[model samples]
Target: MNRIALLAASAAGLAVYAIAPAHAAVLPTDATETVTSCGNSRLQAGLATRVCAEITGTTVEFYGRVGLAGPPSPGGPAPAPRELLTTLSVEVAGAAAPRTQFTSALFTASNLEVRGTADTVPCGSTVRATFGVASYPYAANPVVHEVTVTC
Candidate 1:
């Protein structure tokens, strides 16, 4: 009886070890959540939320939101679709341009549009922007990386 009990316990422990995962896990959000709202936030029926991301780079920042603003009434079906609002704001960090390096050009020039550029920018740093939906229409939620800015 004693031997049987010990065998059962060992087998149970082995089973548990076998079932356990070999590695630490990574969550979907960790890689998927970009600065963009649509790319970062989960979509549901008739939901509207805004997300803003700030990047310090010479490249342009394109913005968009995720999910449709929900239905009109609590009991009613979902409302009409909401369109994306996309825009770009230029960011600068240090030393006024014309003399400032690309990384330190925090002040907004002609195309760049941003407020409080002086306060937000740090000295001597370059910024580039990139954005996209990793999962796209399917919603895989991939990470957004830097893309070179054009003149």
Candidate 2:
């Protein structure tokens, strides 16, 4: 009888352990402030001229919580890549507001030079460029804009 009781207790404990929540790799689900570019120019597209601005700053923010599969082996941390994924430029806008949608990852990091022409206005206008990984969402929406410099 005692043996049977011990076996049942062990089984129950095992069941509880299995049912309890086990820590899984937590992925970061948030947005972070990145770089900014300034300086814009007016250019002719087809019918009307367009204004393009450049923003300089840390545009890529880390997303997705990265950790070791198990506790750091031998007290050493697991290997994590320096760069996770490619950065996508959302839009270029004035007044620190992102006008374009951050949907496509079409563009890439350029040589910090102005190419196209912006038909809006010239430098001295407050322009903001927002970039981020499209997967993650912002929790608190940190301040992305600093000084409204010319660009």
Candidate 3:
């Protein structure tokens, strides 16, 4: 479906989720990860999310994942994150804007994930590379990690 439709559906899901009490021995909170070469973890609603990108030789290897923040609750319905968007780009010398390499459609899952590799402009030099993701349900902001990777 389109983004507007997807967003509306997610909102409805949230409304349903709002009243479903978490099964808590202690409690669970959302854990999320942002743009990093190795990946970072931080989200809300007992979900954990991460994205990583690293350059090796002339290629960038990337990984993104979502999972339960803690052990499965006996009865709590964990929130599924919406992977709104993902993008990869590379800056070209003297170019007004970076060239787009990839973009993904919306994905919804408790175990959301993605992994792939893309060639950098070249292997001999440093290049400005970027990895980005826009997710829902607990993301404070969309990730837009830019880093210089040497091949």
lDDT of 2 by residue, 76-115 (tens): 6543332222222222333344433322222222112213
Model 2 TM: 0.24
The residue ranges of model 3 lying beyond 4 angstroms of the native Cα positions read 1-37, 44-47, 77-96, 99-110, 123-140, 144-148
**What does candidate 3's lDDT look like per residue over 1-151, in tens digits?**
9999999999999998777543211111112322235435645333465655555444544555555566756787744444455555555345457655455544444466556555444433333434455555533332333334332
User: How many residue pairs collide in each prediction?
Assistant: 9, 26, 7
Query: Which portions of model 1 miss their true places by more than 4 Å?
Result: 1-49, 52-63, 67-72, 95-151
Tell me which residue pairs clash in candidate 3.
Answer: 30-43, 30-44, 30-45, 31-42, 31-43, 32-42, 32-43
Identify the superior model by lDDT, candidate 2 or candidate 3: 3
Model 2: lDDT equals 0.29
Cα lDDT tens digits for candidate 1, 1-151: 6999999999999998888543311111222232221123333222332223333332223342334433357677644333322222332323354221121121111122211132233323333222212221332222222222212
Most accurate candidate by lDDT: 3
The better candidate by TM-score, 2 or 3, is 3
What are the clashing pairs of model 1? 46-70, 56-127, 57-127, 57-128, 58-127, 92-106, 93-106, 135-140, 135-141
